[model samples]
Target: MASEAAATGSTNTGILGWIERSGNKLPDPVFLFFWLIGILIVISVIASLAGWAVQHPTELTEAGEPVVIAATSLLAAENIQRLWVDMPTTFTHFHPLGYVLVVMLGAGVAERAGLFGTAMRAGVRNAPTALLTPIVVLVGMLGNLAADAAYVVLIPLAGIIFHAAGRHPIAGIAASFAGVSGGFSANLLPGQLDALLFGITEASVETVFGDWTANIAGNWYFIAAMTFVFLPVIWFVTDRMIEPRLGKWNAEAAGNAMAEEQGDRPLTDGERMGLRWAGLAVLFVIGLWLLFTFGPGTPLIDEEATPEARLTPFYRSLVAGFFLLFLLAGWAYGKAAGVINDHRDLVKMMAGAMEDLAYYLVLAFAAAHFVAMFAWSNLGLVLAVNGADFLSSSGLPAWALLAAIILVSGLLNLFVGSASAKWALLAPVLVPMLMLLGISPEMATAAYRVGDSATNIITPLMVYFPLILIFCQRWQKDFGLGSLAATMLPYSIGLMLVGLALTIGWVALDLPLGPGASVFQEIPGTVNPVAPAAAQ
Candidate 1:
């Protein structure tokens, strides 16, 4: 044991080793927020004492000039009092908190009822062996809708599937990991992440463009495009590059222990019935949404409003619509599968889901305070204005500017792993700064996501990185952090390049990102806003 431990320690000594060491030394994400809050307080005090201030770019005073914003010390008497008195409200009102909890409340039921697992099994089990790579990769990409469930269920199961098919198990693990982590941003439909990140974007936009609203589907078409673009990349890389390198499946040499441990079990009758019901339930919900959207009364569309204004109701209802879709489908599946016996069983499933989120609740509390404090200090605005000025003076093309944002965001992902946390920090500066540069808030958000997701597979800081390494180790006992990072490096580099190219092309084409979302935000009275294509 000691010799094995020593060898493992030796492997973590170079660049990957340094990253692992440094990342491990840092505090957990929850405590990292507290540390940031503390640092921000001290900085606020210093900046306030130094009389640091800035001229607001857009907001004007009664005198019809740019408004001056001054730093406010977080430790000031009134500010300190507000923090203690409003702690609960601040945490609860955090934008992403409610959005995540509500969606999970329903998704949790689906997962606990075994709907996700059985569904994934059915999909992968039926794939022709010749197309297993793309099937696994595509499922992994769509699995983001299940959030963490994809990592826990699909990835390990993939290894077993590959082994059963007489293919390399590590290659299966690699393909699944590439889809789950590397393709984190690629999905056919939006889910909790869309709500979470856009909620933050809304808050940041309100800081500068007060009337601007966040559309959850702002990056819809781009991300949907990503799902298709990344599929072939994963297929090619796994089949031609990764699998070829892994050689062949040697059940005897690999001990075949893991294969036995995780038998390839086909779906039972009850599971099939449950899946049928779940499918019908999904279609039923879709029918209802469409009926309301286009039917005579048209509750989801405002008849008296402009075409753009008509989408507001539809966009706002998606959160609730998703909730009902998952809830009804899970309930239907659970009933048929015998996983849920009664209403109490359904309640129990939802409660169990919230239990898993206990850590997130704590993290959200800390993060909320940090974000609110940053806003109160005016530090975010000052930095955004200054940053915007610097970028504008550089005379870089808009596409190049967005590409730089994606690159910087990708680099930052290696250090900070939480998408919401990182976006909360960057949005205040990046969103507003980009808006000042003629880029819409949605466009800035789309850029951030491309960069944020491209490097997840390569970063040890990502929460699931260790978990993915453990999954790989099940196939090759010697697989360490460095080994996993090296395996995923190609996907990371390739995906980042693809993401950058997509962003550049999307901007150059002047396409609408989603319903009522444009590539540029027109300054009122200064220029006419570009009309977006009507939402379908």
Candidate 2:
């Protein structure tokens, strides 16, 4: 795909060309994990033989002294036995796997029932032409709540809507892709990703601070802010930068006959009815959750707990809450839209959703093993301790360290496309290391998300990259990988810069990242050593 892009146009030459070529040669992400596991094993053996060890910064002996941790050789007889015996347990216990699968069970039903598609169409169709760009961008940003449905549904619909409005369809594709994939982490509401990533973050935090709890909405406010920040970036880049460069839409020249033929169709009576009911269903779900949260003897709040603990259940219930919301709304829309005649159809929709996750299940198995091995080797802790020591000695401003993390993560993203897999690998080291530097786990996670999402659009390895290209080809057959990359490069760069700036400013201002989440941590009897230096 990358080579096809490079060969098709001059727009993808230079750095874009190099990235495509290099990224295309990388192994499939699933295989890549197996290779990483092998490398990790070899490295563990070498480190163990070489007597590599670190002082456990957080864990102390009974005498109140720091403990020493030594590298455990993966080649050890006992370790090899445990690996064989615990293989199934490791895969099953993988955090992201369960979180994603559970959420998708509900999301899949919503998507397959036509609720997501109808909702997006309704949103875009109702917007005045003048507000189309921002509306499309906003819907695309919020579409993350539906997981992959946004990429498949919104990108193509944006193209058709633009063509009907006599604008460049490719520009619509650019705008939608920018919001859907490029600004992936930006959403007003927490979704499956929040649960999945925070699950990993919680695991990493527990490695250093055993009592820390996971909050799915740890970065909620920041991501909400990101949605607004990125909305303008996509709108301006699509309107002023990309569309002008492509010139006006040429109906005859542009091979988008199919799009032009379809034009803009008014929603059917059934769809309209379905949407109304779905809206009511959404409100009903929200009301139920509130009742559980704030009503007398609220089930979502623990009366016997401290004020902070009272909200923990509420926060944790959001995952199941969203599940019910999607499930009920989808069922309501399905019934009203005439897509579901009975309970059997709903069951089928749920089953179909699981069918689509077959590949992810396979990938998760390999990823789970790699993560388990990394933890067992104690290499993540050793690396975190050493890395934290290096950073502490360097005396770099905390913001600079965070900026560097975002940059590195963006660069690595060009090669590794799975957000969960990448986070699983990095969090073990980065989370604890930052914690040692007085940065909160949530802060480390926020910085990682900024970098992780910024370069998604330009990377061919992203699961949806080929799908986006296919969407583009519907408009211009000659539009190859390079064209897609070129079209999205500006958004990638702009959003990355904006995201980096947001991270730096958010840290400097010491704003709460989310409900009860902060940018810095205070260890008992120790000053917050990695506090951000005052802005110049």
Local distance difference test values of all predictions, in order: 0.83, 0.84
Candidate 1, position 287, lDDT? 98
What tens-digit string does per-residue lDDT give for candidate 2 at 66-145?
Answer: 67777889989988997999988888877777777787788888898888888887889767889889999999999888
Looking at model 2, the pairs that clash are 5-482
Q: Kindly report which residue stretches of model 1 are placed more than 4 angstroms away from their true locations once superposed.
A: 1-10, 254-257, 524-536
Which regions in candidate 2 have their CA more than 4 angstroms from the true location? Answer: 1-13, 254-257, 260-264, 524-536
Q: Pick the candidate with the highest lDDT.
A: 2
Query: What TM-scores do the predictions have?
Result: 0.93, 0.93
Evaluated at residue 530, the lDDT of candidate 2 is 26
- RMSD for all candidates, in order, please: 5.6, 4.5
